[model samples]
Target: MLAPLLSDPDTVRAADEIHRGLHALGVRDPHVQAAIAELPLEDAAAARALGRRLTRTGTSTLTVNVGIALLARLGEPEDVPYLKVLGLLRALTRPVVGALTALDCPTAALVWLADHAEIRALRHLIDAIAARDDHEARTWLINAPLDSGAVGPSTARRVAEAVQLSDILGAEQTDTQAVAQAVAQAGRLLSRMTGLRDYRPEILSYRQATTTYTAFVARAGQLPPTPDHYAILLSVALDLHSGPSVLLDWQPGQREALLHALEAVLHNESWTAVAESEPEDPAERRRVHWLRRTARQPFHRATVSRFRVEATVRDPADPDTVEARVLIDGRPLVPEAFGKGPANSPEYLLDSGRLRAAAEPREVQLAEAYCTEGCCGALYVTICREGDQVVWRDWRRPPSRQPRAELPEYRFDAGDYDAEIERAENDRTWAWPARNTARLIAAGLREQPGLLTRWDGQVGWIGTDFHDQDSTAISFTYWPGLAAGQRDKDGPWLQFVWSLPDDGTPPEHQAATALRQLAERDPKTYAQVRGGSRSHAEVLGFPWPEPEDPEVTT
Candidate 1:
């Protein structure tokens, strides 16, 4: 694209005209996008004019894309915030989100795209950015609350891997506040997502790009839409969020306290939700009613949900230079991160409870995923081999007590719980046959990637996020066809579960042993299951591999 532009004046001018036409019509210029990627540089007499344009002329989103290209070329921290703003500009529409990915600033562009819920890919990119870094970029991602696209883990890992390498190579400085703001925005969005009820593929749409569902009814088929059940189960999450009172009514006071809080949300009338809603703008200026919580609970406060994505040069410059994963509410699931591809997946992972993030390239290595800066912020997850059973430990927690069951909600929305708390709410526990897997795969345009490659495809299989039994926690789900033969006795299965607690773990070294036990039981499971964020999979099962709470106390 650049060679043509630079070599031929006609090409350059013609390209300029194309940009003009795209601006006129509401579409981004893919040609302009490619040109910026290929060449971006202009030095004035002054070392820093604060602005040397990527191209002298373009629309707002185009301008932002050009600016992002310029920054990637210059690799300056000063440009991060600006790029962030530009990203916000383009995020308002679909055309921009699709065009921004080819540039080196996929992370920047993705942050902008996922800010709104109107488009499905927005959540896929959110998983990529949030899972990739612990900085402010992740903050933006968390605030977006993806569209229940199980691509969380796959996309998160891809972005995380890229960020880690860039940091190791000193590509970018740590800009905490900027990224934190992003995370906060993403989290707030998730709280309100309960309104955009999950779509039931009970009917696939031959054409579905309009706001008026009524008008499309004629064109759209009722034969289970392309992405029929791809919507986040917020309207259906009651299955996991709800539990019998006795499940939490333990002798200890903490057990009772945790149970009561969850019940409040599971049964609260205000928490009542309508899965689908009319499309409306939810920008920073727009009064996103859900964000304006009447009251805040620990489920919303003490906890923070983010994706810790990481991609590496195990080789870059490859078709998919990125790998990612999504962390739901707060948990990370390596299986989905490495198995599913997120860039295009319709549904994103929301059920993962924890993940291990890597910042460097190696034949094989494991790293603990970091929680946000808030309350000593959960555990820095670590897993290791221990006999036939895998085991885990919180490098940051006390060696004495380690949590294993799913974690408890940090804050409960006092908005509408009771009215929504029906038996279905309590029964939604992790997508059956693997809710995360089914929902994430269901969102894609083609046969799920996992189905095509588990072991033979170019990238093999990338995993996405899947919830175990907890809305705030996640458990690893298997990639279709990704199989591992045993060392003799009984080889590990193609897919397996590490029943950690979404139950209720404290801030300290709570579930260390449980995680470690998981690693030991099936050391290869993580490798076979986890890693990568912009990845999705194809599987066949329902509520398969039910995870048990790996806690000894309970």
Candidate 2:
């Protein structure tokens, strides 16, 4: 009876009814389970039917559980996409979770589900991974794509950290010495992974963007009233700040909805103060906020400003030769010295060391100028003059080394002075948050010294600082031999210090204290550090300690 129903495409309902009756009879029927499990994994219809029956309104709980167990045992990776569709039904939650857990390779299934499953189902997968408290699960969770409509980066990071902490705590209970050694090693691994520095302006931007997105979406009726819709909107908004062209095909209303959402999201007392200080139009005020946020994004930081091509000089030797001395806001536009122009004209001089009077004066604009302090000193633009109005074209970075003429151009009017200045101002705001995030992480580590002692490479190292300068100094001594390249030099230990701002002084001290505790608690790491290289220590601003004798107990 089961064989005929299973083989015939039209007998799905009959097969399900018979299976349900068997389930009702307390027949933990191996034959039925075997028949279901033998169905072709590629058969989406069969999988969907089983999945639907698992959640059917009148299905017995035992039947659903039985179906889940069978699916878990037999479902192939190929069945995942269809299963994901079934996973969307709230009624199937228990069975779906069971099936996911039962898969031979649950990690791959979870990842695929996270990417394609509905938000609730994705969350279920995340929760399941978090509960497992294992390295492979944590790593997969950490590497899972957060760009999916279901999960945002901030949430993903939090989940990863939680799972990491759980794993660390679990390990610490079993073996203190081993966990301590792992923690010390994790510090070194994390330092290398993030270039031995803690401060990340990009992370600050991500946090800020996520905050703004959450706030705006909470109040904005424009987005669909679902958590998944909110997550997607937030991701889309962040993408917009980085690159506006991604949303070029969106309706004006949609773009404005996002921008308006960002506006509400980023509005703060400081912005209010800035607005109050300026006598600008409401439209300009909004543009200022947009520009300010965009400036923080690496993709949108290339700024365009209005300029007047005061004079053009044509080399008498060549008719096609042209040079222009541009004025930005009535000031002579002097390109940065040693600045390389765009790749199209690498050595092309935008401003001659000395000014040349223009034979032909026309208003123009410059786009993609070095707007940030650490600019690579390049000027890229599409300058156009229409009558008395000068319009600067939005300059997109070329995909490859392409000639200037081949670069794509889009219209960007320079009439929005307020917006341009806002972007320029935002370029200077990155340092504060970068410093603060580092301090916050450091402070957390200081409070929980045990956390460092339990660090496993499987869990992320969140408190490691990225770079240090001497202007403000916080120092720690650690055996340099523990670090990757420092094992061969004549040093028992190396002192690592970072120069932070006056405001960062306390956190830097706290970080140093935490490092000291880490070094003292982990003898294995201490032994490795004792053998570190002299040169590596010197680079980190520490004189190498005296070389350790091979037999010395100290």
Q: Using TM-score as the measure, which candidate wins?
A: 2
The Cα error of candidate 2 at residue 98, in Å, is 26
TM-score of each: 0.25, 0.26
TM-score of 1: 0.25
Q: Write the per-residue lDDT of candidate 1 for residues 5-56, one digit (tens) a residue.
A: 3233343354464456546766564544566556533442111122224322
Q: What overall lDDT, based on C-alpha atoms, would model 1 receive against the true structure?
A: 0.30
Candidate 2 lDDT over 160-216, as tens digits, reads 343453344234235544443333322221112111011221222232233333333
Off by over 4 Å in 2: 1-238, 241-246, 261-405, 408-497, 501-554
Our tally of clashes for model 2 stands at 15
User: Which has the greatest lDDT?
Assistant: 2
